[model samples]
Target: MNLKNKIVIITGAGSGIGAATAKLFGTHGAVVVASDINLNNAQKIAGDITEAGGIASAIKTDVTQYQEVEALIANTIEKHDRLDVIVNNAGIGGKEQLKTAEHTHDDWHNVIAVNQTGVFYCMKVALQHMMRQGHGNIVNVASLAGLKASGHNLSYSASKFAVVGMTKSAALEYARKNIRINAVCPGFTHSALLDQLLAVSPDMGEKLKRFIPMGRFGEADEIAEAICWLASENSKFITGQTITLDGGTSL
Candidate 1:
């Protein structure tokens, strides 16, 4: 688990699980490149890491834009000279914006653009770099919605399902090339996304926890731990798999 001097690029690093993961990786001695559409938030997170004596840099990234994603990857490589880990965690929970089939086109399109296409773009760029390095780790942050149906969450589920599919395919294609790809499917994690979902269905949050049997929502750190492990050599033998950190909710 010693990631000293490792170069890592994390998307959606502005807030929520992505932010937590970025900080965790940085704290573990990884030189982290934290990217987010919100440049301010990204800068703040990177600043905090630096203040704590962790190596980190911030960059503005619109994951849906291939050019932006490519630039982010290129910048990371330019600054660090090599990329060791890529965490494609940039995504949106459309549980609030995308309510039904008849929802606004803008809402639906935005979710798909950010959640699905963004992941694809990140993987493509990261893989290109990793292929040259002959070794890399890719961890895509998917969701339980990718595995099960979550009503009123059309765009979010669709995007996550696509991510799961892409992760599996990429993993198989790169297994022999020394590149590992995996997905972490979290359920009912505490974040802005969850807050939006809860706002829509106040009691649903409590009900959702009941289904987990653990009777509680998960912490962002819980998911971050999974990402960190998957990104490490400890998971060298693991790939093309989706690890669920939902306190047995999917069971």
Candidate 2:
């Protein structure tokens, strides 16, 4: 899959899957716009790409705010004259894990605002531009939790499931317009988010690893490869589907 000269925007590009993806796309000849809530980290990744002779720019953005998302798209157009691809990868887990009945209002609302509503903001603006241009691609970073229920991650699961539904619904509407929309559901990936959770319960990682048929957690680059394919011309006919990158754990 070739992404040469593609103007790509990746949110949560500071670390983990997003960072890995930004680098991969850069190497594939994309002009990457890396956005994250943390300006410092975003700049770091962008700098890394630049040092490696890749084109990139960093923008500090909070996806929950519609205006920021609007500006993110606008800025990309201002810089590149077109928006070619977007990876809605910014997401958060509950501040504290909670059961369905125990979820706090703050935790539930925050998770949905970032994971669900954030995707909506990016897609809405991107579709408007893509419709006018008559071509574009959007890839959302959902989770395996979105596909199946997991205890104590209620807020996150709810937001991701909404993303799954939204991906399909949007794909169907825009397929004829040449705008392909899809989602990636990553399972037990070794990311900063996973490390933070593992730090709290060290043995949990090993316990979770046992469930995967491959007996391993996915690497960030592995997930990045899938995102790149979904955003590339190679997936010209693929849309409205959730590509699960689990190590056969769901089966």
Count of clashes in candidate 2: 0
- Residues 1-251 of candidate 2 have per-residue lDDT tens digits of 78999999999999999999999999999999999999999999999999999999999999999999999999999889999999999988887877788889998999999999999999999999999888999999999999998788888998999999999999999989989999999999999768866876869988888889999999999999999999998888899999999999899
Per-model RMSD to reference? 1.4, 0.8
For model 2, which pairs clash? none
Assess candidate 1 and give its lDDT. Answer: 0.90
Query: Once superposed on the true structure, which residue ranges of model 1 sit more than 4 Å away at CA?
Result: 95-100
Model 2 regions more than 4 Å off: none
Q: What TM-score does model 2 achieve against the real structure?
A: 0.98
lDDT of each: 0.90, 0.94
Residue 33 miss distance in model 2 (angstroms): 0.2
